[model samples]
Each structure stands twice: as structure tokens, then as C-alpha cells.
Target chain A: MGSRIEERFSETKAAGRAALVTFVTAGDPNMEDSLALIKALPEAGADLIEIGMPFTDPMADGPAIQASSLRALEAGQNMIKTLAMVKNFREGDSHTPIILMGYYNPIYIYGSQRFLDDAKAVGVDGLIIVDLPPEEDQELCVPALAMEMNFIRLATPTTNEARLEKVLTNTSGFVYYVSITGITGTAKPDPDAVSRRVALIKAKTDLPIAVGFGVKTPEQAKAIADSGADGVVVGSALISVMQGHMKRDGKAASTMVPAVTDLVRSLAGAIVN
Target chain B: MTKSDLNTFRAGPDEQGRFGIFGGRFVAETLMPLILELEQAYEAAKEDPAFEAELENLQTHYTGRPSPLYFAERLTEHFGGSKIYFKRDELNHTGSHKINNCLGQILLAMRMGKTRIIAETGAGQHGVAVATVAARFGLPCVVYMGATDIERQKPNVFRMKLLGAEIVPVTSGTGTLKDAMNEALRDWVAHVEDTFYIIGTVAGPHPYPAMVRDFQSVIGIETREQMMAAEGRLPDTLVACIGGGSNAMGLFHPFLDDKDIEIIGVEAGGKGVETGEHAASLTGGEPGVLHGNRTYLLQDEDGQIIDAHSISAGLDYPGIGPEHSWLHETGRVSYVSATDSEALAAFQLCTRLEGIIPALEPSHALSHVGKIAPTHGPDHLIVMNMCGRGDKDVFAVAAHLGTDIEG
Candidate 1:
């Protein structure tokens, strides 16, 4: 069977619009609320879901996603619990593609083959390991592909024509095009510049290009969608909203889920329109 | 390990920068071109005699190279077994061996036409070293340090500021060396064009571990010559404290081919490994990735990088150099750890017996000497790298010893 990532992009293509990819740390606030939030994402208009695997040192992330990971880890989130959340989400919504995104250390420690097997068993369609570049593809990317999992690769502003060949060699599913040179949530990408890069990347690969990092609001999502991206991803802004709704005691306030879903709805609506 | 593998140990990193599946360019794509550019620049610099001459000139006239390999008469007498020698790198101009690598990297930064320098520091020795070089070369420098480190290593913090370097205090992920490094990498990613990152240790990406080790191998090079001149032979054992394993790798890389000499790397056992509060990556951690290199890292079962604990800020890092990991796996180097109390006692012992105030980083190595020295015969010679001076560590050590000093 082909990946749900491919299936989702095909559906979005049929709808003549970009997919809305929503990101959330798997156990942010707590596991129960996190599961509830993810289950609500698809109906609220998220075409694809990216679940963050919380790590202590998220070097590529900005402050907001970093805080989200810490919150998840502080609430006792681990690979087991993260997968369990995916399993739970898959039970109700098998059509929505769920991508696990984070660093590679946890999966390296968890055993790559075992992680791929368990992740596939729990219906995790793709992975976006932030720290694993194409040079170190043998570590996990090759094994992940052998397991028929979509090993998504990231394309950035610094990825030259020669290097792009290496990056796309074993990559399947969608290509994540980082809009800015800095870490997540640091700076906004100019739509004209991002559009040029997205067009260049589309010329090189058949995989759908998803633009992320620094796209914060509905307008930003609309701009990225207009830039020829197949999907528009918003992470730090959503996490920031949830953070704002958190109580002083660190528990999620009653508005946490609604606040997050409302933002996702707005972003999705922007792209759909 | 086989003889072929042992013979090939010196030839590693192999184009893509893997120390047998350890070090690689595991950075974001935005940093890939910069890393590759750095790799090319470093390779070219390695072959250029003028680059070597300039670096040597800086080492000799500026950083005070060939730091003496002095025999510790009292400590050796007290140990009653091996004759202990101190590779007095603490006598270097910046008060640590960190300057050795900084001088080399700064020259490269200039050669590459980069106008700004960035670095990360734990105990602040590396920060001070980078800051000093930045000042000397008239380049703008920024040092990323944990807020806790800035508070604890006030002297070095003041020194960096005095050198006219900007200090960015990082308050993320337990606010230590690893966090500081993350922040620095983020800064490098943001300012890749005009900035050159002088990584403090033999960690991070590929060219860094190899390049930093190349720069630091001067320690081993000097030690080899001095030991041969003094005793007409190599030392039986070599010991060095490891945070990111730069100093240890500096002293170990040159001697890796010598099958007869034993190498030991001491890691910080903050309270003790049993207490789950230590920076002993090889001793207590599993193989994982952090910063950039895949090495022995202190991480939870689910792969979250765990905060490392140590009384010494320099050794309080959760990951080690990938070369150290490869050496450990190959059984070329034996790794051990020493507790905070043990290191404190060793610090006091070295100060009293040797009349030298040793940094807490090297005190971990000295602690191991106390244990291993008694077992070996007097004919055995042990050289331990005194990587830093204790001046910057006085306040921390004083507080640890429960002594109050009013400034």
C-alpha cells in the first residue's frame, strides 16, 4: 500500500488547494488533553498531522515549540506514550496522515527497526527527524524506507543543486521546505522568495512540498499556500496559543483545546479558501 | 579490535566525517552548505604551510606553546607507585589548553574571510579563549553561556566581557554547556554568512571534532617530545579529563598508534554514577546523538537528552566527542569517572602537594591518578593533562568546600 501522505496530497490536489498540516507535541499539558486535541484536529480541517516527539534539546526549534516539548516531557511523555497517542488517534481517524517529527536520538535508543515497526503498527505514516541529514541516511532513513515508511526530508535555503540530489535520493512522501534559515519561529519568510524556492524544489522532485517554520497566522498560511506549496504547516504559533491558555499551576486551562482548535480551523480555512 | 582496525584508527572521519558511524553532518539543511564550506576550508588549511606557520607563531608568541611536562615530585612520592608527570597546559596564556584550538580556528575564520566569531563555553575557559582571540584579531565575537555558568564562573565571564565580546546568556534545558551549545548553533544558523563558529570542544559536526583534535594534538605532540627527552621513552599511561573529550582526544590521538601506551579518560561522577547525577557519558550513558555527533550521551530511555550534573562546569556535559566513542568501542581507550567529593579531595591534594591550584576539570583526572597510581610500580610513568588553571574555579570550589570569601 502507498503512504497515507501520498493519499492525503492526492485528495488535497483533487480539492485544488494546499493541505493544512498542524503540529502539536504528543503529550503537551498532559497525554489525555493532547490526545483529545489531536482527535479534534482533522474535523477542524487539518489535512495532515505532525506530532512532535518531545526531546530535551530541540536545537532547531524556537522557544515556543521548545517549551511545548518540555511541557510534554515534564508530564511524562515518552516514545511508548507518544505511539500510544498515535494509536488512539488512528482508531477514530485512519484517513488523516500522522507524521512523527523530532530528533533521532530517541528512536536510535529505542532501536531503529523496532521503532519503525512499532510506529507503523500504530499507523504513523511518516517521520521527520530534524537532526538526520542525507549524509547520515544509513542510520535510519534506509531502514525506515525498507519498512515501507515515508522518510520525509527537509529542504532549506542553503540546499544547493548538488546537495539537493543527495537529500532527495532516498526521500519518500512529502518534502518539508523550511522557509527560513534560522530555527523554527524565529523569522518570517518573504512569500516571493519562498515561492521561488518552492517552485525550484517542485521542479526537482515529484513529492509534494510542505512549507513550514515561521508561518504563524492564517494570513501567513494563505501566503505560503499561494507560494505553490502543497501543504502549509504552522507549529510554533499553535503551541504558543496553547501555552497562553495554560494555568499558572502549569495545567491546561479549560480553553486550551478550544483555543488550539480555533487557530487550526482559521489556518485551515485560510488555505482552503 | 584487529590490527587493521587499530591501524586505521588514525585515518578516520572518512570524507563524510564519520568516526565509524559516530560523527556526521547532522545539522539542518540551512547549515549544510556552511559545514561543507568549513570542511573544504579546513582541508585546505591543513595542507598549507603558511597557515601552519601563522598558527605556530600564535601558539609560540601568544598562547605559550610547549607547556612544560613537569614531574610532580610530591604527588608521585605520595602515590608510591607510578611516577606522575603533569602536562602543564594550564600555563598557557589563556590559563587553559582551550587557546590552542581557538588560535587555529580564529586563523581559519580570518582565512575564510569571516568577520565575526561565535563560541559556546561551559566553565568559560573556551569563552575567554575565543574572546581573547577575537580581540587580538579585531573581529566581533559573541559567546553563548548558560546563565548558571555566567553566575558561577564570574571571573571568566568578566574576562570575556573585558575582552569586548558579547555574552548571550542561555536559560534553556537546565542552562548548562549543552544548552549553551544549542543556542550557539542556532545563532550560527541564523548568521551563517559572515560568522564563523569556533566550537569549544571536539564535538558538534564533522570538521569540528577532526579540526579541534588536529589543533589540540599539539598537547600530545609536545608531551611525546618532552617525555622522550626527559626519560628516553614514552609514558606508560596517559590520563585526561573529558567533557566533550577535546583535551583527552588531543593527548590521545597522537598516541593511538602506540599499542603499548595505555590511555584513560576521566569523566565527572558528580555525586556518583549510582546516584544518577554524573557527567560520565561513556560510563553511564548510551549511544545517542546530541549537538551534532552521535556518541555516548546521557539520555532517558525514550531518547530525551538528560541534564548532566557535575561540580565542575567544564565537565558538566551529557555527550562526548565521537572520536572518544569510537576509541572506547575499539578498546583503545579506557574510560572512568570520579565523584565530586573525590575530585574536591584531589583538588586539595594537588594544591598542597604540587603547589598548584588545579581546575576542577583536571581534578577528575587527578582523582583517577590517586586510585590507579598506587597499583602501578614506580617505574611506570603517568602523564596527566593539567588542562586549565584553577583561578576561575576558586569561587565554586570555595563554595563547595563551605568556605565564604568576601569579594
Candidate 2:
């Protein structure tokens, strides 16, 4: 039984377009609105979903996503709530791939083996731990692959050919090629440069390449998808829109879910066109 | 934990940078290559005599090395028990031991051909040190200081500006040392090409914890020699305050092999350890990963990092150096804490008794010294690290004491 992530990529490839990967911090704003947003994602056109487990310190993320994680934590998000969000989403939709993404401290605190067990039980398809490079594979990656779960490693502009070999060693599912050298949501990546880098990584691995980090607009996502990426991941852009609709009292301002889903639909339409 | 031919405490952080499952290069892929490059450059620097000679010359003339290890005659008479000695590192250039590590790192940054230097500072002592070194070396320096720290450490902030270093105030996560570090890491991630991050503490990633410790180890090496010249033997006990454990690690690393010498690291206990408002990571925290390495961190059960509180800004961090975690776990070093009130009392006591105003960072150690000194007999000798001067902390201390000095 192939994982849901691999199946999604294969299906997207069969449809002759790149997959639209969307990310949102679980429990952002609040749990009720968060669950509603997650359930609404698939129909609005996200082929793959990445739920960020809120951490107090998110060194890799830029301001937009950092603020989003802070919002989630302020609303009392934890590892259990993050996993439960996935479980809630799974009850309605089991076909769309769900990946948990964040730093390793929360999971390390949750116990890696136990987190994997609970995550797998709740239908979490993959993981994208930002801090755990290939060097510290024994901590989570190797064990994750052993359980037949996908451990997606991020390849950046700094990841040279020699380092790329190490990065792709135990990596499963797909490769997240960070388009820029900086943190998430900061600088816009040049599509030409990103395409070439993705092609270079593609020469080495059979796994699909999903270009992220500064990918926001439908036009930008379409441009990267047209240039040969198998997937386009949008995060900070979506979170920025969600931030606009959040009330000062920390409640969703009613336009939160619709506004985000509308943006996702446009991005999906651009990718799947 | 005793040093033997077969088992030396010095040989640690094996090839993968693991100090017995404590420290590792827990960073993003973008930082891995840069970390490896730094490790290579440092390895070569260690082997080259030219590097050693240059560092020595700077330490001697620039930083004024061989910092006097003074006998605290009055404190000894007052306590009337053990003979106390203070490793007077506060007399160095920039009025703190922070210059020792900054000089070594600025030289390394030059060797790496990095044009821009960035650092994160808490109380601004490390910021001043980095800024001073950058001025000497003619490199453009940027120091990330938390907004709260900038407000509290206005004098040090001005010192950095005077030294021609740009100070960026970080307002994230309570606007303290941890936030500044997070901001600096984010800056490093963006500008990885020609920028070198000069981490001020014995924390962060692999080479940093080990490298900063080596640079700051001059304190211990000199203390060993100075004690030998003064008393013809090693001291009975060694003590230093820990803020990310750099100054303490500097004094303790060289003595880890001495079976008879007891090493105590004093952490900042805000109100008290039980109040859940302290920065005593070893005493009140558990092992967790933050700022690129695994160490004892003040975190909740759900692993969210808790904000640390302490009277001393330098000691207000939630995490500690990874090497300290290893040393604590191995029972090679004893970790204790001093409360804000205790350290404040020690600050005034040292100033009045010895006529030497020690920084609040070292005051934490001095407070611990007051407790343990009277417990020992006259033959018992104790050495505590006076890592910095209290000039920068005077305003904050005055405010706390309700002196109401008008600016």
C-alpha cells in the first residue's frame, strides 16, 4: 500500500499538472475555525495539505508564518491538538495527503516514536521537520521511513550536489526545494533559477520536486509549475490573508475561511489548468 | 569523570559533534554547509601557529591578557573561613571577559573572508565586545538586541553605535536574548554568502559551542597558571555564573579533569527556582532542542519554550550550552542557582568589600561563593570568575534599588 502522498503525486502527474500544496498552522486563530478551514481545503483545490505544529521559536519561517504560529500557540495549540486536527480532517476526506510540518522540539517532547504512532494512527501522511537535516536522521527520519511513513527533506539553494546525495538518502515521498536562500516568505524566487535548481535535483532523485519559500500568487505558482516543478507549495501568502480576517479578540472575523479558500482556489486553478 | 590516560574529559563531541547525546549540528540544510566550512576553517586555524601567535598578541596587547587573579583579603576576613580569590577578567578591554571570545571569533571571520559580521546580545556586554572587535578589524558589524534589552541596556546600545556597529532591536517573544538570537539566526539564514554569525555564548550549533568554549578557555588556562604561581597548586573549588554557560564553561572546561577541584555553575534564579520564574535551565528545565543544539531548556510539557525572568539581562535566557548539559549529566560539574535578591546583595557586598564592582552576570557566582565559602575551613581555597564590570548594570540596579537617579 503506497502512502497517500505518493499516490497524490502520481495522480497529479497522470492529470498532466502539478499538485497544489497548501500549508496552515493547525489551530491558528482558534480550533473551530481551524478545523473548518482544514475540511474546506480539499474542495477548494489543495491536492496536498501541510499542517504546521505551532512552536514558540520558528527560526526558519519569515514574519507571516511566524505570526501565524504565534497565533496558534496563543489559542492553546499543542501536539495533541495538531494530531486531532488531522484526525478530524480524515473523517470527511481520506484521499487528500496530509503532512505535518514544523520544528522537532514539539515532537521530541511528544516522544518521536509515540508521535509517529499517533500521527500514523490519525492518517498523517508525511512530515517536514525544518530543523532536522540529514545528519540527524537517527532522531526521526530513519525511524519514520521504517514505519513506511514519508519523511520529506527540504533542499535549498545551498544544498550542493555532494550534500544533495546525503539529503536524499532516507528521503521519501517528495522533495521540497526551497526556492530562495533565505527564510520562508521573505524574498520572491526567480522562476528561471528555481527551475534550473529543481531540474538539477530531479537529475538525482525520482521523487517529485515541490518548489516553495516565496511562492505566493497564482501567476507565480503557475509560472513555476509550467517550468517543470511537480508541485507548488503556498504558505505565508495564505496565512497573510488569514491574518487580515482575524479579529482583535482572536476570533475568526467570518471572512477568514472564505477569503483563504478563495485564494487557494485561484492558486489551484492556476496549477491544475 | 576524572581525567585518566584512557578517559580524558577534554576529548569530547565526537566526529558527529555529539557530546554524549547532547550537542549536534541541529540546523537547516542551508546552514549545514556553512557549519562544515566553519569547522574546517577552525580546524586549520587550530593547527596553524600563525593563528595562535596572532591571537596571543591580541590577547596580550589588545585585550590585556594575564588578567590578575586577586586575593579578596577583606571578603576572606569578613567570611572568616576560606581564602577567596577573584579571577579579575573585568579589567580586560571593554571591561568584560566577553572580549576574549569576540577577538578570537572576529579573527576567524576574517580568515573565512566574511565581510559582514552579525551577533546577538542580551545585556549588551557581548554586543559591546563584538562591536569593539569589529571596529578594530574594520568590518561592518550588526548586533541584534531584543527591544526590552535595548531599553534596559541603553548605555551598551550607545556604546555599540559609537563603535560603528548597527543595532537592530528585536521585538519578538518577550523581546529578550532568546528573541534576539532567533532574529540573528533568521538574518544568518538570509545572508549566508558573505556573513559570519559570531555567537557570543558557548551555545548554538556544534563548532560554536566547542569553538567559543576554546576561545574563552584562556580564563581557565591562565587561572591554572596564576594559581600555581601564587600558591604552588590548584585551587580547591572553581565557580562562575552561567548565561548560556560561556563564562562558566571558560572557567570550568580546563578543570574538568581535576578530580579534587569542585566546579559549581551558578544559574540565575529569578525569584526562586520553585516560583517558575527563573532562568535556571539545569535546575528547572529539561533537555530540549533550540537555537541549533540540544541542551537543558526552560520549556513547557508541550515543548513550547517558556520566557525566562531574571534581574540580570545577561542571565535571562531559557536555554543553556550543550556542553554544560553533558557535564551536568556526567556529574563532572555541579549546577546551582542564585536568586535576584541574592545576586543583588552579592553585587553590593563585592563592591563595598573589595572595591571592585563586578557585573551582575558574575554577581550570581559571587552570591554562590558567599554561601559555600563559610562552609569550608581556612585551608580551603575558592576562586570565582569576575567576568565583567558593573558599569553597564548600574542604571538597572539603581532603578531596582529605588535610588531614583535622574538622567
Taking the tens digit of each residue's C-alpha lDDT, what string does model 1 give over B265-382? 9999999999999999999999888888888999887888888999999999999999999888888889999999999999999999999999999999999999999999989999
Q: Which sections of candidate 2 miss by over 4 Å?
A: B1-6
Root-mean-square deviation of candidate 2: 1.2
Cα lDDT of all candidates, in order?
0.92, 0.93
DockQ for candidate 1: 0.79
Error of 2 at A109 (Å): 0.7
Tens digits of per-residue lDDT, candidate 2, B1-407, equal 43243266778778888788898988988898999999999999999999999999999999999899999999998888889999999999999989999999999999999999999999999999999999999999999999999999999999999999999999876789998999999999899999999999999988999999999999999999999999999999999999799998899889888878999999999999999999999999999999999999999999999999999999999999999998888888899999999999999999999999899999999999999999999899999999999999999899989998875
lDDT of 2 at A84: 92
